[model samples]
Target: MPPLNYFVVESPDPVGKDAYERIAADVLQDLDLIKVIDRLHIYVDPKIPLFVAAGLLRHMPRAIRVSDFANVNPGEKEIVLDISEEAYLAPLLRILWARFGKENVDQPDRFTVVLPAGVIGQKEIEQLVVADPSETLYKDVIYALQYIAPEGFKVRRQYIREGKFYYVASEDTLPGDIVERVVAPLFEKMGVTL
Candidate 1:
């Protein structure tokens, strides 16, 4: 396997939940070559917020492509979708509903949906609204970072470019050296040497 190239350091500020989701999506899109190993962990201390992410560098999973997650099946009057393992559930459902009409689609669970017959092709679903194509993925990543941070902490961030992921926590000012020292022993104890 390639050497691990992504990191998730804690942020200095707190961010809302929605913002964090967007940031995670954006980062996955921007790095375009990284696979998120796990969901981001946001911890809110009384004064500051922290973030931790771990993953391998790779392309993000495609949202519109049927193969990306859902399997489309043509039924007599509706299209049945088996989306058991797909991650982008919300956006996919939104797009499907918008294209097929709210009344035409039925979502009984997180992993299954029924689309009316009139809208069974890929083109219709692919046209669903998404984040502006012109917008940089980094902006989304930052938004996600903010969302993932605690509501009280105030900070922003960018992609994890180098081996060391960067972060700015809060006005309180925690030094980078101190963070490294603190994390080092913990990683060492866990038998993780980077």
Candidate 2:
């Protein structure tokens, strides 16, 4: 599928659409989230200090497993992880330590961890989850929206699911019909039912 199409669907100030587009482009590119999104509809009403960002992601990112990053060797009483890539090394070590404890988990080198002496089953190590990119992407999207939205609009609400997200921000307490006012019209225009 193609990358997400981002647009300023509605804004209080039509002239400001260009600026918002620029900001969105920069922020999305900076976070490496441009391609993951399939469509983006943003609405900003500075006069009311309201901003909404709604988008559908292309697909859910896959979970990172222990096998994805390291080679697992199951021995008689322990499993040794030969961490090939260092990118997930820290988190991998942290998870191992958390699961097996500081004493049970050992790191003799920068890229090695041993689950000394058969405390857990072998399959557990193979199926360990190192990280979930979808979770991280959700947080990144939330943080990016904070930057994209006007600063100081602290009241925020977000709805994120498998591969879709909706966010809203405002300075004051938000009204109930805000979604109708902000996202519904954009969705309708995009031919999206919800």
Q: How accurate is candidate 1 locally (lDDT)?
A: 0.48
Candidate 1 lDDT, 115-140, residue by residue in tens: 77766575544444433322343344
Model 1 clash count equals: 23
Native RMSD of candidate 2 (Å): 2.7
lDDT of 2 by residue, 81-151 (tens): 89988888888878877877899888899898888757766677768888888888889888888888888
Judge candidate 2 against the unseen true structure and give its global Cα lDDT, from 0 to 1. Answer: 0.81
TM-score for model 2? 0.84
